[model samples]
Target: MKPTIVFDLDGTLALGDGPISAYARAIATRIGDDSFGERATVALIAHAAGETSYRDGYHAVATLAAEDRVSAEIVSAAYDDSRALLGTAGATVSPPEGLSGFLHGIVEHASLVLATNAPDAGVTALLEEWAIIDLFDAMHFQVGKPAGLVPILTAALARGRVLSVGDIHEFDLAPAAELGADTALVGPAAARLEVPATMRGRTIADIYERISGWATSAPHTAS
Candidate 1:
């Protein structure tokens, strides 16, 4: 069977201009200013860092919003509304070049799974908008990249060599590497974290020349 390849959604397969901007705009409009929106984002991120678990992280952000009298229902509504608007308009989304062809070429030789920090509903909408949902074998959401992704992939695919393709080094590549999965860091820049030399076996730049070589060399028949 073909090797299982996992992907990060935002800033990897899809461009990164959806919910964040919408949230900021909504916050600004609601509070009658932009400063409050910025503060809310900063506070939300800070809250996320103090959590011990994924559920904790989610609740932390929810707590902040609640404290500010921001209704959870409203937040959820805004997210859905923004996603629907973007899906139909496609004005805010930028599809990465070569993504369709790349996926198409390897669809016959590999299993593609999307692993992302994007919210479940939003991710689903984005996939539908891009018309690429059928390409993936499975998807994991709001899990913050490869930190717990190796196990999820293992469970989904049974047994196979795993390779992760993503743009974020810390969230998308490092943890997968630590879990014995191959990693191809997509962007041109190096990671802020210091990757150990031994763990560097599968690193690659997001260039066609390099990608072609890696895809061809990794022998696997599509299941």
Candidate 2:
């Protein structure tokens, strides 16, 4: 069987200029707290993104803004509102250029799966918008990373080799690494995490190129 490549949706396959910071701003706006500025919001999000649960990130934000009476419920509401806004308004989020072609290049040699912390509807919408939904063989949403990766990794490993790719090292790559799967960390911040990875790059395109090169050079064997 071909190796199964598991991808994270938010920052890996989905390329964006500053969606995380933008999301932070939205949360701050919804909370109506002046103290939760974009910088602070970004910091909180970044910290949470590294954790096992997405809620941990939200809780951290609320705790950091306790002076403003920010609660987990409030943070949850803000996050929902931000996602709605991004989905309806077609915010700046988008897939990388030539995404379809990139996927096509590897589809024949590998099995593709999408695993994300985002809601299924939201991820589906984004992938549909990008016209690349068909490229994936399966998808698992709201899988709390670094912890919830077991089931997904177990399933993927049953098929063949596994390669997990994502932007955040701790949330996206660490669990896969622990499960003995190859990992590709795609962003500068990934370097901050002490996890071992098979590849590290600034963008999904870089990962694609590397995988493509490997596929081309790898030795072929009869089934």
How many steric overlaps are in each model, in order?
0, 0
In model 1, what are the clashing residue pairs, if there are any?
Answer: none
Q: Estimate each model's TM-score.
A: 0.64, 0.79
Task: Put down candidate 2 lDDT per residue, 81-104, tens digits, no spaces.
Answer: 556655444345667667788988
lDDT of 1 by residue, 41-69 (tens): 66545533432221222233345456678
Residue 103, candidate 2: alpha-carbon lDDT: 86
Candidate 2 clashes: the total is: 0
Residue pairs in collision within model 2 = none
Evaluated at residue 92, the lDDT of candidate 1 is 60
